[model samples]
Target: MESLKYHRLQQRLGYTFVDQKNLQLALTHRSHGATNNERLEFLGDSILNFVIGEALFKKFPEAKEGQLSRLRSQMVKGETLAHLAREFAFGECLVLGEGEMKSGGHRRDSILADTVEAIIGAIYLEAGLDSCRDRLHSWYAERLAALSLETTVKDAKTRLQEHLQSLQKPLPEYNIVDVNGEAHAQLFTVECKIATLSQSATAQASSRREAEKQAAAAVLARLGL
Candidate 1:
């Protein structure tokens, strides 16, 4: 990527690096070469968990430990990180190897998510924890504002399972009904079957995990739980 692109990215991140090289390495993927972003990713992941954990604790003082943990998990998951990456157009700045480049690694969720963490690490190394926390807050402002204990009491699957367990009912089962589309843009159709329900709840999404979540969500609606 060009210097102009990095400058634009820094503008989006709300933090400019004292040493631009750190940012460069943060944007580098392992596929690019040996000295890549893996270590930085490790550091950044820890920092993010700590920073977000503290933020959640302060924002939701009444939340129990389990609620806080689940909320943090949702925030730091690969899906949410990838969403943040897309917000900053991280794909345009990622440095990938030839093979990964040709295979659309720039748009891959795991890759994008890792780069976001790497960037967080880079920011900390260039400046300090305060800068890193500020950037995270900027990126997550809308999401933080939207969080509610009622809406995220539990994930759809967890809620469904708990409802069943409460009544001494058997657990729900999930199956892959179909998978379609190309390698990078595939869609998964998952069916959720509960012993008490006459019909199965089905949903489709870009990944099996997401598909299952949707299917579980559908089942939640069906059971009115």
Candidate 2:
């Protein structure tokens, strides 16, 4: 049954593993056992950065170094990887330990993001850089097409701040409402409040910065920006 599910995931990914064990290893979290996807994730991270950077270099020859760096960062960020993971329905395919399973580890952004990288590494190992690059290009086709030098990719907080400034409203305030879990693996809840607006937005994430960013994004959504 599990193998059948993985087969479906391969179809979705548009790459079939020559050795099924590589696919299984890529999906196995550290919590599952000592032999897990951490090594693959590391390799995949480097490959992703290099491939995306190369693509951006070719796509925008006139772009400055900073612009290329920022573009690559935006494309390879954990949030973007998590979004891709959701699109691929990767949560159901994750292999986690009993504790992690009970705690909804499969749905975690970090886990999903790491799993995506791990799969990339697995593909590189099984085939080669050419095959890995082709897969990445296919995966990021829409996102790559959307890129442009005319508009810079700004983070949610920066966009929110600039938007409010244009409307003659005071900058938004962020407050930490709650913190949960262990020190190393904490969850932070942040509330983003705009004085001019009656409604505020709150979001939770593994870090304060990320939670604040999410809160700001929520406020932007409310304002239809």
Candidate 3:
């Protein structure tokens, strides 16, 4: 079932194999390949840690182990791998049999992410670490943003800062523009500014910090920042 197009894609990945079957096996879904990429994915998970961890070690010498570990964790998360798989359009290339295809298998994160690891394992098997590392870095370039989504989405300030940084900058600034009426019935107007983009919101509160957060939310919506 080899095709020139698939072969060209394999060449782009930089690992041409004698048995292309392992590579094919890696791409197969459980519905198609029986055992599927699960086992390969497990092996790839460790290989990914080894490769990305080594990368972090070299990339940030001054970073403490905690910091480096955090970075690696971000890279290898299921959501991150799923996003990375999309970037390479791996979802489109997944070889699902009739049953899995009918079940929308391509959209499954566990499946797609496992395929990514299996492909990495296939690379490792064919050409070893250097080749596999190169393919992985190229594949993972875009999903690094998923890391900036923060340790959790519940922290608005952290999310906002990360969104800004993904654009290569720091958090936006909010300034109190006006306070209207009397102290008992005060209204605050706060402006959130990021570079040239600005948004303002007004809220009644007993203190300034609460009003600032409202303004920040407005700015986030304005720039989608």
Candidate 4:
């Protein structure tokens, strides 16, 4: 039954493994056992960076280094990867421990994202670099094709700060509204306050920086900028 499920997942992923065990290992979470996907996640992370970097370089020949870097970061970030995982129904295929399973670990963005990377590493090991690159391109096809120079612009926080500076208005301030969850996987809630704006904007994420960015994005949206 497990093999059948894995086979279905492989069909969805558009890649078959020569050594099926590698694929199984890729889907196994750390909480499942000592021998889990962490090593594969590390390996896959390096391969992903290189594959995406090369694709960006060729796709945007006229783009500068900073622009390419931003594009690559957006492409491989946890949010995007988690989005892809959902599209692939990766949550159905994960092997998590009793604790994680009860807590809905498969639905967690971080876990889903890490499993995607671990699968990438497994693909490379079972097949080869070219095979891994081809699979990555296939998975990221629509996203890569949609890239534009405008998408490489600075993040919301930087843009908001610059907009305020241009008008000589007081800079935006970010305050931690709340922090929840365990120490290792904390969720930070941030409130962005601008003196010019009457109301504060709030957002939450797994990290302080990401929470701040989310809050800034909300503030920007509220300000209609």
Question: Each candidate's TM vs. the true structure?
Answer: 0.78, 0.76, 0.59, 0.86
lDDT string, candidate 1, 1-225, tens digits: 499999999898888888889989999999888989999999999999999999999999999999899999899988999999999999999998888788898998888998999999888887899998988998999999999887556778888889999999999999999999655357799999999999999999877888888899998887776
Instruction: Give the higher-lDDT candidate: 1 or 4.
Output: 4
Look at candidate 4 and tell me the lDDT of residue 142: 98
* Ranked candidates (lDDT, high to low): 2, 4, 1, 3
Instruction: Report model 1's TM-score to 2 decimal places.
Output: 0.78
Q: lDDT for every model?
A: 0.90, 0.93, 0.69, 0.92
Instruction: Please write out the lDDT profile of model 3 over residues 1-225, one tens digit for every residue.
Output: 447656866665556667878877888877775657768877888899898888767766677776777788767866677876776667667888786687677887767778888888877877788888887776665544344323423334455677888889866776787787543234566666667463344443324555666666666667655
Q: Give one digit per residue, the lDDT tens place, for model 2 in 48-144.
A: 9999999999999999998898899889989999999999999999998887898898888989999999999999999999999999999999999
What candidate 2 gets wrong by more than 4 Å, as runs, is 156-179, 182-185, 188-204, 208-225
Regarding lDDT, does 2 or 3 come out ahead? Answer: 2
Q: How much is the lDDT of residue 174 in candidate 4? A: 98
Give me the overall lDDT of model 2. Answer: 0.93
Off by over 4 Å in 3: 33-35, 141-225
In candidate 2, the residue pairs with backbone N, CA or C atoms under 3 Å apart (3 or more residues apart, or in different chains) clash, namely none
Q: Give candidate 3's error at residue 148 in angstroms.
A: 9.7
